[model samples]
Target: MRLGAIADDVTGACDLAGRVAEAGLPTTVLLPAPPAPGHPSPTTEHHEDVFAGGDDASACAVVALKVRTAPVGQAVDEATAAAQLLLDAGASLLYQKYCSTFDSTPAGNIGPIADALVALAGADGTVGTPATPGARRTQYEGILFADGVPLAESPMRDHPLTPMRDSSVVRLLAAQTAAPVSLVPWEAVQRGAAEVASAIGAGHTLVDALTEGDLDVIAAAILSAPRPVVAAGGAGVGTALARAAVAASGQRVDISRSQLPEVPVTGRLLLAGSASAATRAQTAAFAGERHTLDPLALATDDRALDRLRDALAARADHREPVLIGSAPEVARAQAELGAERAAALIEGALAELAAFAVHELGYSHLLVAGGETSGAVTARLGVQRLLVGQQVAPGVPWAVARSGEREIALLLKSGNFGGPGLFTDAWEVAP
Candidate 1:
């Protein structure tokens, strides 16, 4: 692999992988192996089985870990192992990919995980930004904004897992790590790569980027840094990183090679498990066979599982896609059961249903919404890696995976990504 990215979640990994492929590098997204018997989850294992159809020597990779909200130490250890696997596989550049919202608590998985990757890569420090303009997320003067509003004043502030109460990346990162946090202002970024590179130091630098040009400048600066370079960002910088990597190596990626890999198209299902505003809108906008799982009922009642299973079974002969999701009232569920407990319960139930749909119902085309939901579903389906395919939305792509002889086409969408028609319109471009 020429460039490796360690993302905190499945959606982020697919998001970065899509950008990398857009830059003309054939990309793959690898999920960490499921734990062995009696072992903890997210145990790292070298996946030689990935990139099934692509040339390993020419392809890039993104390792998606279920650590966005995991405990700090666990996230660090898992991410470190993933980085080692990528680096040992011959990746010269490492990109730490997270959400454009910069989702994290004060005791971060982002800061600590980045610190670990930086140490493992033996880099001076990493520069990061969550500026994905197409997604309406951008940074200026080290402060994150969503659709022109400061992050703290935006919908992300009400996030269930990691409420972003502050918009300043410098302050948020400084609160999580003992090391000093620095900034590369737009002034330096506009001056070009050399000036931005000079601003980097032995501590994490939060670079400002409001446009694609700024991202190119920031990515060029990262490439020009010392060997074994490590950087961080969302999909915006990830695209730039891929471009810079190809340019630095004097490579000519065949853009015409962009096409979705062949996979089975039967038994299409849309599983929505996120309560984000975008996801809620998508669920509401979808005009199809929809089944809503009440979080409270699913957590407390066993028949909820049977009902959902029967619902899927009833659709066996139907060709229209079915949309299944939990109730949108996450706060009520969290109040009834603790936050983590409620999330675990819902995710576990959803994961079980996904496996049943794929294995028992013969589902091959799956659209999963939400980071945590996608992680659980993919793990339950025992998917180790995915081949990145044509994007159905900005930062959202069709990922193809194989389970034995069955090829599954998965479109894993972040809860906060995609339009209202995402759940319905995505099928028009299925692989």
Candidate 2:
């Protein structure tokens, strides 16, 4: 693998992988076990088999890690281990993927992990940007925005996991690391890559970007370097790099877009585990049977799992689509079950629901929302490998996975992805 990426969440990992694949590079998205502490080498006996399948040195390989919201110490160690595994796998280029909204608290895995990776690679410095305009997310003048509204004033302000109360990307990044931070405005980005890289070579930077063009310029500068650059950003940056490689090679690059198999879309189950305002809007507008998971019930009810079964059964009987989600009130959930336990409970419930639906009930397709939720459900279902297929919708693909003797198709969606009607439209047109 020439290019290796470490994403902080499962859904984000898939998105990052897809962006590179779309740029005509064969790709593999793997969930690897970080090497154990005191055992730095992946060849150690203590570590689980990591990156077992995809080892094509010419391809783009991504290792998905779930430390986006982990404690600082644990996140740093895990990220360092993951970096070593990719480096061992022959990846000369390393990119750390985070959310397009630049979601993270002042004390974070973002800044600290970037510092760790930069030091590990012995690179000049790291670059950070969360500007993915295709996802309707961008950063300008050090501030993050969704559509036209500032992130702090947007739906992300109420994010259940990492409530982004701050919009200044530079300030947000600076608070998390002692590294010297600088901001390159959009004008400098438009001035082209060399200037932008000159600014980044001095120290870590928050590059201003409002459109895909900005990313293209940034990618050109980053890739033009005499040696490999240690970079971290959203999926857009990865996409830019892949496309730049295609252009520089001066040959037709083979982009492996997933193709939908001739399978029917029956026995499909949709799990909405995100509490973002965008997710709430999409779930509410979904024209189907909806079962909102009660946080109070999941945290305290003795028969909560049974209740979930009953709700799913009723929906299954009607052959109507289903949406099971905890309400978007993160504060209520935090107060009721605590953030850590609350997320674990919700994800655990969704995982069980999905396993029963797919393994016991013989369901064939599953549409899941939320990065953490997707990670949990995929783990519970024993999905060790995935074959990325053509998207059912934008950023939502029909991916094939195996769970024992069963082959299941899953569509994993991040909380802030897709339009309000994305769910209904996906079901109406999928395999």
Q: In candidate 1, what are the lDDT values of residues 1-431, reduced to their tens digit?
A: 37788999999998888767877877888888865776554665557543335354346788889999988877887888888888877777788998999899898888898888888988877886989987889998889999899999999998888988999988988888877789989888889999988888877888999998899998888877754457898889888877776776787566336555677566888888898999999999998888877778976787988998998998755357898888777799889987887788778888888888888888888899999999999888888878787788888888789765677899998999999999889988878
| Over 4 Å off, model 2 | 33-58, 226-228, 250-266, 313-320, 328-330, 428-431
Per-candidate Cα lDDT values, in order, are 0.83, 0.76
Candidate 2, residues 235-343, lDDT tens digits: the string is 8888888887777776434433335454554587789988876677888898877777776777778798888887666663624567778766766878877887888
Angstrom error at residue 5, model 2: 0.5
Q: lDDT value for candidate 2?
A: 0.76
For every candidate, C-alpha RMSD to the true structure in Å: 2.0, 3.3
- Lowest summed lDDT across 10 adjacent residues in model 2 is found at 41-50
Candidate 1: TM-score? Answer: 0.95
Task: Return the lDDT, model 2, position 326.
Answer: 76
> What lDDT is obtained when candidate 1 is compared to the true structure?
0.83
